[model samples]
Target: MTRFALTVEYDGRPFMGWQRQRHGPSVQQAIEEAAFAVTGEVATVHAAGRTDAGVHGLAMRAHLDVAKPFAAFRLMEALNARLRPAPVAILACNEVADDWHARFSCVGRSYEYRIINRRAPLTFERGLAWHVARPLDAEAMHVAAQRLVGLHDFTTFRSAHCQSASPVKTLDRLAVVRDGERVLVRTAARSFLHHQVRSMVGCLAQVGLGRWSADDVTAALEARDRQRLALNAPPDGLFFVAASY
Candidate 1:
């Protein structure tokens, strides 16, 4: 058997999430089926992270083991050919050591949240970004976001469904920036709890709207209570930007 690393990109709007689901479609199932079609073997695909429904991926790293004999380039080509019309693409592929796991070996992950700060209705970015009609102070959001950096109990930003052993995590970076009518929130960490990014973005948005002060963010983090969260941003604007090994 051979282990192969894959760089995948997909539109998350058509699936439930990255993992396979009994009631709905998923990115994993689509890729696994495409692999089966190419190799005639049941192979499980593992990803660096599993994003929620409506959360897109720009360069999701994944891996799968196959018993079939094929070159790395040919395997990538075959998978892409079989994955046609699924909105999922294999951007790159390479043979890797058997111990190099996609999830376990990952050292860091990054995500980006996009907000269209405009009153006009979205045309091209309808499902790709969040539209906030009210004007937002990106600088204020950036100031408030800094409070979330470093080690802290992030229960306030964690989802009730989160399975992480502890709510305490070190946020490596969180930055909010605006260009024209676009507000972007970029964050990186070793790993994140369920809805953690969305939750943080939601509270920062409140700060941008002048509803909450920077100290309020500090208070919320210190509270370590989920109810203290100002909001949970929708998945529409979240993107899994990259995963590092």
Candidate 2:
């Protein structure tokens, strides 16, 4: 069998998440179904990271092993044809070394969260962004968020149900910026505990709104308590932007 790596793009609004679920459609199932359409055999596909419901992905990487190899261009064409109506497409495909696992081989992943800070509700971006009716201090949020870049015990930023072996993860980049009305938070790391990025964004928003000082992030990190942090920002604004090997 030969291992094939596929770059996928999807609109996550219409499905459950990346992982297969009993009750709803999933990104994984779509790929499996498409692989069947392409090769006449069902293949198990593993993703670099599993996203939550309502989150979108601009570029997600996954891998599947096939009994026969198809040219990369031909596989992409066939998979996209079968995966339509679910808003998923195979952006690219390439053969990789048999030992290269999509999830475990990834060196880093990046995510972006978008929030609209204004007094009125957005008509065009109903579920595409987080709508807040107050001004956000992007610069303040940027400064406060920077404190999280580096190795730290990030229990405060992890979900209660996070099953990662450890809560210690290094954040390589965290940037908060404003483009017009939306406050954008971009984060990247080698790996993350569940909800880590959203958790950090929630805490940063508190500082952005003057509810917490920048030092509050440090306190929470040192406390190592999940309850010490703020909200876990909504999933709508989050997107799996990219993955690098």
Candidate 3:
């Protein structure tokens, strides 16, 4: 069997997230179906991250193994051709060793959350970003985000349904910046607790809106309790931006 690694980009508004579901469409199902169309053999596509519904992917890393022999480029083109109208694209593809894995081999991952801090309704980017009518202090948010950087017990930011065995994770960076009316929050880590980024963003938004202070963020992290969470931001603005092996 030959293993092929694929870099994928997709608009996640129409699917039930990255994983295949019995009830709805999924990015994995789409790519797997396309793979069968190309190789005439069943395959399973594994990703570096499993994003929630409505969470887009700018450059998600995934891999699959096939028994049939085919050039990497030919397989990529065939998959793209057959995956038409799915809003999912195979951006790059290459052969990898059989032992390589898309998820377990990944060493780093990054995500970005976009918020349009404006009152006007979205026209072209309706479901692509989080629309906040209130003005956000990106500087304040950045200051508050620093509290979340480095290693910590992030139980306060984890999801109730998270399957990870441990809540202790090291965050490399979390920065908030403003590009015109858009507020961008970018984060990097070796791994993150489920909903950790969204939960951090929601509390930072409170600080930006003057409802919470930077000290409150530190306090929350120290409390290490899920009930102390400020809010859980919607998945609309989150994007799996990059993954490194």
- Evaluate all candidate structures by whole-model CA lDDT and list the values in order: 0.96, 0.91, 0.95
Worst 10-residue stretch by lDDT in candidate 2? 124-133
Which of the two, 1 or 2, has more lDDT? 1
Candidate 3: pairs in clash: none
How many clashes show up in model 1? 0
Local distance difference test, candidate 3: 0.95
Consecutive 10-residue window with the lowest summed lDDT within model 3:
122-131
Badly placed stretches (over 4 Å) of model 3 are none
- TM-score, each model? 0.99, 0.97, 0.99
Q: Rank candidates, TM-score, best first.
A: 1, 3, 2
Rate residue 186 of model 3 by lDDT: 98
What C-alpha lDDT, on a 0 to 100 scale, does residue 198 get in candidate 3? 93
Off by over 4 Å in 2: none
In terms of lDDT, the poorest run of 10 residues in model 1 is: 121-130
lDDT of 2 by residue, 150-174 (tens): 9999999999889899999999999
Best by lDDT: 1
